[model samples]
Target: MDLHYSPFDFAIQKDPYPVYKRMREEAPVYRNEEDDFYALSRHADVVAALKDSERYSSKNGLRLEPAFWGPQAEQIFSFVALDPPRHTRLRALVQSAFTNKRVQALEPRIREIGKAHLEPLLSGDTFDLMHFAGGFPTDVISELVGVPEADRAKVRDLGMAIMYREPDGGPVKDLPPSAMAAVGALVGYYTELTIDRAKVRQDDLLSGLLDAAEGEDRLTPEEVVSILILLVGAGIETTMLLLGNAWHAAAAHPDQKALALGGRIEDWVEETLRYDPPSQTIARTTVADVEVHGTVIPAESRILLMTGAANHDPAVFENPDAFVLGRDTAGSLAFGYGRHHCLGAILGRLEARIALEALTAHIADYEIDEANAVRIGSSNNRGFASLPTSFTAR
Candidate 1:
């Protein structure tokens, strides 16, 4: 049998499902020689690996490459990249802001921002949803988390460059010199912002973090910076991909677009997640030796959970290839499973729903400019870098 997979295949970046399908059927747990990391493609196996944190620890770090953080910095980020008591404590410190009620309270505000940004574009015949509709949430999260409006543009640029990886979902080779400079600038800006927030103390997530850090579980000042980076970086990048991908998906399917526009956007959002998840893969490292589906993975082996493949497993979802709105696969590991599941899942869903609803409701028809709509150069995230479209406003 021949297996053709690399961590930087441009073709796979455009559409990885076919390759993932082949992987799931033929090689449920495959180790790619190119990257030297093991991948789990089947839904059941991936879910089990995610849940069994003791066996599959996160301490090895989630990124495909090492040195994203220096030795000391890596230890701090390992809070998310580790298992058990540490992940639990750190996650609990920030979990309150991501609760259903907290996310629900922001829906009206999100809708308003969606309308404000989208309505102007609706009057135009065509526009790039990635810039207009998709970019709105990045700004929204920045504002909600107390990033001053003036600094958000810089934040967005830095976040996008850092998050977008190569096609095979591998980390970028290294930040360009300019990007490195931008990182320093961003860190300085956020450092000042954190100091100011400490003084003024407003009603925002950043302020909440300051207040929450009371006793032993309290986040240090540096930890606060790390969490802000995670929040702004993860929040912006994932939502941007979701909105961008959802728009592209809807433009391709008219009936589904109509259904989405007709007050059924949640179905469309869910289907989009199942069809083309933003976070295509997540990594876990084994703590103790573990055998998954007859494959013996040594302790300390890195495991990659292919969420894109897991969502399409026929044994889990009926007609896995077909995009059926409102089809509920109760066990879809789209947001992942167990302790390290996305903290902002609800916020992401709400943002996607609002963006999709606004676009479908306001635009008569839109088509993807395939000639120019490029995929973001990231292995772990799957979405367009730019989605130019022509549309008629309703």
Candidate 2:
């Protein structure tokens, strides 16, 4: 097969690892002039770009969708699209809310949510784990962010639309009308939620952010709304993929599944992130001319950090394609790097760990119908839209 890479292409989406491996070995600095982006596939180059925020700035936007650039994007993205001081200021405000103690405190609730979904699935022979993956994360995040139960369904649907329309979604440049409507709906809903929470002060992350302050410096309504929108997008998508990929990996590799069954699910979870990261790519625009691997990326040009490829770079990990336990994942870029490492990293890992624990404990044996699995072609991440599986109840 040709070693072409296109996130929007379903062929590449089904199995990107082989192409990623080729990119690392053959075109370490792969260029897609047609797509208007330069891709870095090697671990050394990718990590260097990730850390050098001064040159390869995320200020343009980290999403693979180039349309999500500009002042307007920041208004909705909050700190995710900002550089240094601005990013630092906004990120610090909410840092306390996701602290170790606080995230650990949510484990009981996360476990409860995880087990609730598993027990019912245990009664059935065939089920799509994607529902559990998609539902559990949103539920936990919604409750944490104080989204009222009555409104969660509507808001969750809007969030999905805002990211990607279901059933053959179109390009970002030509987003469906419903997705466009979702864009507005999300901002309005979050704006109202932030305002209401500011007044009532509930005991949830939303209220916590409303109270997130440093003397006179506090989160403005716009900032609060932006964070809420970001939380919804980031919180659900990646965590869902993390869970989906973990189960998929376990099913594909019996050695890993045996390990998971042997109370080594944590190792499986980490290996899953490294082997198949929920987020495959991170985009940045050059603020200044930079040279990498003898390839000079010009200023104002787009750079696609091939994190998915880097996770499997042979120089970084031995037998890079294999999902083996106890592999050294110290330098894995799964949660990102430098100033933009996911703030929800702790929360995401905790959620995946608990969910994996529940699956291994309750579902004794399972096999995913990969031939018919629902694959969603996304701009930045790769994951199943539905993973139909037949399982044996424990």
Candidate 3:
């Protein structure tokens, strides 16, 4: 079957793997002339491209369009757009904060936050999982980044507004005034907050960023705001979608869900990430000519590393379509690989595991209303917008 991959297609959002499967087999290195980008679908291609920063340089902004790419995106997006030493330098400054020890230390607080949100929802028969999962991460991120409690609601609202991107190939800076205003609000909020945290010195990520002096390395004020926005935006939206996807996967495969409930919730988290990752595609621009599957992509070309497609590549797994418990999902591109691997992988895993365990503990089994469920669509991300579920009290 010939494949047409449109990120905005709601039909594609409904069930993208079949299309992805065809892309992997038929057109591993597919080029969409209309969209004017090259897609690398197969597991091997995607993995190689992600690690080959020299050839498929991320320096030209991660998105397709120049309006949101290049210099404009660099201003706000920080290191995701850079390559090698620059990317390495900026990453090193903040990498210590997300170390395994640090993420482990935050487990108790993650449980507390998870319980506080889920407790209220158990009172009702039906509730929106996204709504419940959304704020928990934002709250945790807010506390970590020193976002004041009083302003978290507004911050989250602004974050949601900034998160929405038009499907059209336009620059985000050219987005609607409301969206632009929300960006402005986030910039202003963080600019002031960065300055405040520098002086007060709280035990938060922002404060650590202020004083994290590894020899001569340190972050500029503007750089701090940029990274904070990147972390806050990526941290909240992706994990929020992940929590919903976990339930979406469980509802679709009852047997796997049942097996997961038998004290193996972490496997469900891993499988959910493999099946419907919160991030479907990670975009990049070629710094030089690169060849994949006998196709030569010219330098300055836009490339879409289809992490979603690669996750289900049949060559790498036994049954890519079906959800099974405890499969060997090694080399999973869900958190990505290479120089730009996800910084929050551990943190995201911790949060999702806690959320799922708590949900299963509360209601041994829950039915997801798939007919009413909505999928989150974006040029760069994928997952559910809302996953409503009902369960009898245990």
Candidate 4:
């Protein structure tokens, strides 16, 4: 009956598929006492829960922890955490920015940015990929969102703080006063930017959102600011993890590295996403009583969808543990499925592909400095906090 996993389990953090497999087979709808929540570990059950938003609402909040900033933060976070109707409306206002055409149009610019950032790092014999290569996408997204080049650093810092919480599932308390001050300053800066964009029309996504939201179901200024926050926070960190994971994969499999640098770079990116997703899990709350894999979940029970586990489910994928490039994992839930699927998935993929291509083309070889590299100690996200790698410039 006690099938809960501790968030601090280093072994599980490193490789959780085995434990997930056991959960899926033995207790797909197991409840944990530590977090006081139910979990859906199997591929089929997680997919059904994600798609059945009507039955599993997100209004209570997406995170495992309770909200601290009151209803405003709750409402803003609800964009991802809410069920349909309201979620559909809010999502529509900004969907254009992530359209296939728009992301395709940005591909060239993203490539250029990747090269520019990677070039400087290649000069050094060793560098932290998390800071240099992994961080480049943050600047790229910032620029695309109309953030001034000078303030990109501030945005990055705030994003890191917001996305990563402490091991106790609480807000980071160790941040210096200066860090909090920076967060306050950035929030005010974004507020002003939203106001400015509202007044003057521009060709950016913010302007487009302002124009589009003028009439029916119009988003308030606060909503716009919150959307911006979500966009930057989600966009930067996930992409950073993708890049770092790719480097880690390549270093582990020399053959895959050659294939990636050669003709199958994109496939490698997809495989990495499947093998080691940035978002390890997503949470949902049951709106009504539901039975998953014969286990009953009571109404209002929190359900954790282990995306990382589902991606490795043997029932859906053959040789799930192997990181085979170009494998047909059509049903892979790496991006999540159904309503709350990642809005920027295409853009994230393109960024990772371009970054990998540039690195493999310019660098001769690389190895992960496991001793120095730091794994981010969080349950929700799986990624390196600092990935130190030594590479030879080609």
**RMSD, every candidate, angstroms:** 2.5, 1.8, 2.4, 3.0
Would you give me the overall lDDT of model 3?
0.80
**Tens digits of per-residue lDDT for model 4, 117-150:** 8777777699888876556888787767777778
For all candidates in order, the CA lDDT equals 0.74, 0.82, 0.80, 0.74
User: What's the residue-level lDDT of 117 in candidate 4?
Assistant: 82
- After TM-score superposition, the amount by which residue 393's alpha carbon in candidate 2 deviates from its true location, in angstroms, is 1.2
TM-score: the better of candidates 2 and 3:
2
Model 2, global lDDT: 0.82
Model 2, TM vs. native: 0.95
TM-scores of the candidates in the order shown: 0.92, 0.95, 0.94, 0.91
Ten contiguous residues minimizing lDDT sum, candidate 3 = 166-175
Which should have the higher TM-score, number 2 or number 4? 2
On TM-score, the stronger of 1 and 2 is: 2
lDDT of 2 by residue, 1-394 (tens): 6668766566666788899888988888888866778899999998998888888887767765544665556765678888888888889997966567878888898899888767777676998999889888888888788899899888778877766634355443335677768888888888888878877997788888888887899888888888887876689888988888888888899877877877887788889899999889988889988887788888998888989999998888999988898788987999998888899998998898898888877777889998878776677787878999998877
Error of 2 at 304 (Å): 0.5
Give the distance in Å from residue 134's predicted Cα in candidate 2 to where it truly belongs: 0.6
